[model samples]
Target: MGRILAIDYGTKRTGIAVTDELQIIASGLATVPTAELMDFLKDYTQKEKVERIVVGEPKRHSNEASESEKYIQVFLKALEKQLPDIPVERVDERFTSKMAFQTMIDSGLKKKQRRNKALIDEISATIILQSYLSRG
Candidate 1:
């Protein structure tokens, strides 16, 4: 089976993650500039076999769609237009950044390292992928 890819979309940067070809383990792939995300995904998908994509849907504390949803919706439409063959799914992304921070602490990353927002984005993407995997 092809890999399952995950995206943690952000305004400035986007986090990417992918499951193994066997679809067992999810791992962080990369953090790319939001403007270049489409090109990056097009290139990566050409190099790798991706069966599906999971995008994190931001939600507020009251479960309403967050302000960021507008951006994500635009990205989603572009993504679908670009990669029409691959199916896309959305997962609620609440507290993922906080969880990613905690994971960095648990992983023993130093203070300076933990301060890298790119790394946090990557970790959050991994968490999103793991969440998708666990649901199945």
Candidate 2:
């Protein structure tokens, strides 16, 4: 079986995660600049067999789409246009960033290390992928 990839899209940078070939474990992959995201994905997918993609759907606690959803929507459209074969799925991304921060603390990362926004983004993507995996 192929791997399942996940994305945590942001205006500046994007987080990426991927599961193993058996789709059992999720791990942080990379944090790429938003402008380079499509190129990175294209190259990665070409090198590896991706069965599906899970994108974090930003939403507010009130059940409304967050302001950032507009950006993500645009990315989604481009993703669909660029990669027409793999299916895409969405998972609620509420609290993911917060959860990632807490996870960093719980894991005993130093203050300086935890301040890495790119690392947090990568962890957030892993969390999104793990949530999807657990749902099934």
Q: How much lDDT does each candidate structure score? A: 0.96, 0.97
- Candidate 2: clashing residue pairs, number: 0
Record all residue pairs in model 1 with backbone atoms less than 3 Å apart, i.e. clashing. none
Q: Model 1's lDDT to the true fold?
A: 0.96
Name the candidate that leads on lDDT.
Answer: 2
For model 1, the superposed segments whose C-alpha errors exceed 4 Å read none
Q: Write the per-residue lDDT of candidate 1 for residues 1-136, one digit (tens) a residue.
A: 9999999999999999999999999999999999999999999999999999999999999999999999999999999999999999999889899999999999899999999999999999999999999999
TM-score, each model? 0.99, 0.99
RMSD to truth, every model: 0.5, 0.5
Roughly what TM-score does model 1 have, to 2 decimal places?
0.99
Q: Write the per-residue lDDT of candidate 2 for residues 9-119, one digit (tens) a residue.
A: 999999999999999999999999999999999999999999999999999889999999999999999999999999999999899999999999999999999999999
After best superposition, candidate 2 residue 115: deviation in angstroms?
Answer: 0.8
Candidate 2: regions farther than 4 A off: none
